[model samples]
Target: MSDRAVPATPPPLFDTAVVAGVGLIGGSVALGLRQRFLARRVVGLDASMDVLREAEALGVVDEVRISPGEWLREADLVVLAAPMRALEPLARELAPFLNPAALVTDVGSVKSGIAAEMERLGVRHFVPGHPMAGSERGGVVHARAALLENAVWVLTPTDHTPLTALSRARTLVEHLGAAPVVMPPAAHDDLVATISHLPYLASLALTHMVARDERLSLLAAGGFRDLTRVASGDPRMSRDMIVENKEALRCALERFRRQLERLEADLDEPEELLAAAYEGKRTRDSLPVVKRSLLPQKHDLVVAVPDRPNQIGAVTQALGAEGVNIKDIEVLAIREEGGALRLGLESPEEVQRAAGILTGAGFEVRGRS
Candidate 1:
């Protein structure tokens, strides 16, 4: 054995990141890399000049490229945040432009299709990633800086994927303050099929079921609204996810059908079924709560304040004067008197600073734990 101590190599710094689709996920990722990693430059490529312009105005990227094929040659990291159907074609188009050593990844919810395409294209550095963070709303307009914060970002690396590329991808995810979990591609598909794809179909079905009965719309309340909320998501994107993950989704649907059948068979005794459902709720509630610290941590401050115009602006302005960055803000509640607002800060010290500034400014501030 050699006596010399081998020095650890420094993390690879991406010279430039190219996001192929400047929609919500792509725009958000570009913004995150620029803000968190201090990336030298970030370029966005989109077919829509309007979206490209919007992305530039939003500071999601340093520059926008009208043509994706031309910019792919220079990117150190190429992220495909396009729809599932576009991935195969995009990979084929990008293969020749990509540097042999550069890393390639996609934010597609389905991995098997993309991975198979990458294999066919002979792309050695490709890694399949899915960030489990999104809202029912779509497009760059709704893209948030803290969208990926504390979210479970899964990486499904195939046997052919290069280890160095996988490490770099994980580093990129960590830099964005996301929790990274690794699993086999098939397993990842199966898991997401159950958790994500199934819910989407169920939501759509629930929405359709209600739409058939015009009178049901008036009867719809909190539970109906909450359960079918995701049905409001982009129809195109939902269609893509369902088609791309068809096999896994089919299996999941079968399981769900069996459960529904059992419930239908037990429906004669409505009270017993209702009691069983309550027991199910109790079992779910009995599960231990996931500790906050166990998840990725971020600095945040919550404040209880009167519901009035300009109060938020005042609080934010005070913090801005202190040079503190506000990642996100949520107006939690509002009554005739007051409401609670939660502000996500960039650091714990900044949260304290914001609390002090708001409190001194005569607003009731709550320091979040």
Candidate 2:
């Protein structure tokens, strides 16, 4: 969150930060808040007692409470990291309790519905966010501070959203090592419906179709595994995401259906379908390697290093000297000799400079994306 080095001590931005859920996204945000010193006091609210117990034990939150009252009122920043279904009602409860100057944000996938609810509740300082980061696995145990590293965290702010709320949410996104992209609520829903929501449904259909075939286990390979990977994620979360943004998803599904129809019509002319496939490939490949961003998008590079005590710091210091800020550093596959470590930086140029710095310092720099 500072200029370069992971601060030994960081100035807190919020007097109190409250996370309304203790699952993957919520827990990860809580972990980031602590790791980055983004908040002076961190608290969590979850209906699940088991989740609260796990989150507290994991030290993601300083305190955990089942219901909101004083805790909600004390928070300067409140993140509704609960399911999409939970946000509407939760906003209703917090409508009366929130600090007048507090900023409210959410990790819900869809924003239009949330925007509508906030409007209905007269919630002034609300920002809707969706961090395009997470794994197939869910829950607090799997939450990691680096889960958001180099990932996209979108802020969907309508004209009604206060500038202060938007700015605060963006700062939190960057502090967590994620790039923040700003857009309208409807535009975000329409965009993700094609890229995110559609993939989930497609993966679900493919996964189900394969499951019904007894021989699928034998035939399945990397391609099948890759295709159905989205389907393996938490079912309840996927269902909530799908149901919440049904309108945009409906349009996306219809478009996909039309594409299928075109391919079906081309069955008699195999070459036509092949041409269509090639065109699709070209369009997909043309998409920017870096997703669109409001800030300079963070880039990642892997460094192969000797398992020396200060090897990682050596790399960080090298970059720090160049004014290249390392957002995150992850050590991977440590062995007796050396290991691969990933460095996340604020831009593509920083990634290159950091990689060069590490390489010159006698560490092997590999993967960059």
Candidate 3:
């Protein structure tokens, strides 16, 4: 039940991974790669030496560097984990240092601008990746091993991108315990603008609207708290994301405004509007719950089980018998011969219960506190 007791195998892919920027996403990727892939060398680069040292001390990376230019040439894959505004400049700086065949990816929230810059720089091996995961928290200190597990990682590759490079990039993402979904550069931007960028703007605006009124702040409760939670994000990073994806975000905002106006106009017909809203909610809730990328909580666990018939059922049953409820479960690896199953349980107690059952049933289990 615990991450350490799981018998997950390393990914069969590249050995060396260099993360540029030891922030939340970057640090999480480094941790996932090192833990899941058993990467030969996981190196981290950051603008702040103190942050770099912290990342190394946290064991997210085997080593640390101050600049991407110093390590990019030798790394099999280079991941830019900085803010969107930094991606374009960093891409230009790293383009020359990158190995001709090495795969390059980024964790920037915005894709279109960075993708364009990569294309212009003739970075043939580039794959623009946006892991649709994160928390309001930022920085290396919040980096989590299961950050990308089961989360949708979108990659936008252009025609000029080499097939081999894209394949390797996908392998790297898989190794980091993420699900890679491919799309065109433009489409990726458009989709994220609607789902991601617009939401951030709305959250911030909602918070501002409440905070501006002294009396409203005092009356705010669970609904307002939950809705404005993401507004607590790092201002610099949020600003960068909004600016980098300005055009798409602007269009998304306009569409959202129109919807709001329609609802206001229908306020007189309360019952009809309520029914329409209820129908919309039903339709929205019908969609599959995509696993979101989130910082690992203190009591979380990642478990791995073999790819065998009835294995999942057996494991779930074993946990259920022990009264342990699984918070989340992901098939980290699935091969014809064997695979890895990662599970996130609610607490260490649940993990211990599940671990005892699975191990008693002859399954190898790893646990991470």
Q: What is the TM-score of each predicted model, taking all chains together?
A: 0.74, 0.75, 0.79
> Mind giving the per-residue lDDT tens digits that candidate 1 earns over 167-202?
988977876667789998899999989888999999
Kindly report which residue pairs in candidate 2 clash with one another.
none
lDDT of 3 at 14: 55
Model 2 Cα RMSD, 1 decimal: 10.2
- Using lDDT as the measure, the top candidate is 2
Give Cα-based local distance difference scores for all models.
0.77, 0.80, 0.78
Model 2, which residues run further than 4 Å from truth?
Answer: 1-8, 286-369
After TM-score superposition, the amount by which residue 150's alpha carbon in candidate 1 deviates from its true location, in angstroms, is 0.7
Candidate with the larger TM-score of 1 and 3 = 3
Q: Which ranges in model 1 have alpha carbons more than 4 Å from their true place?
A: 1-12, 268-279, 282-369
Alpha-carbon deviation at 263 in model 3, angstroms: 1.3
Tens digits of per-residue lDDT for model 3, 23-124 = 999998888876554356888878899998899778788888887575677788788988777778878877888887777899887777888888888888
**By the lDDT metric, which is better: model 1 or model 2?**
2
Lowest lDDT 10-mer window, candidate 3?
Answer: 3-12
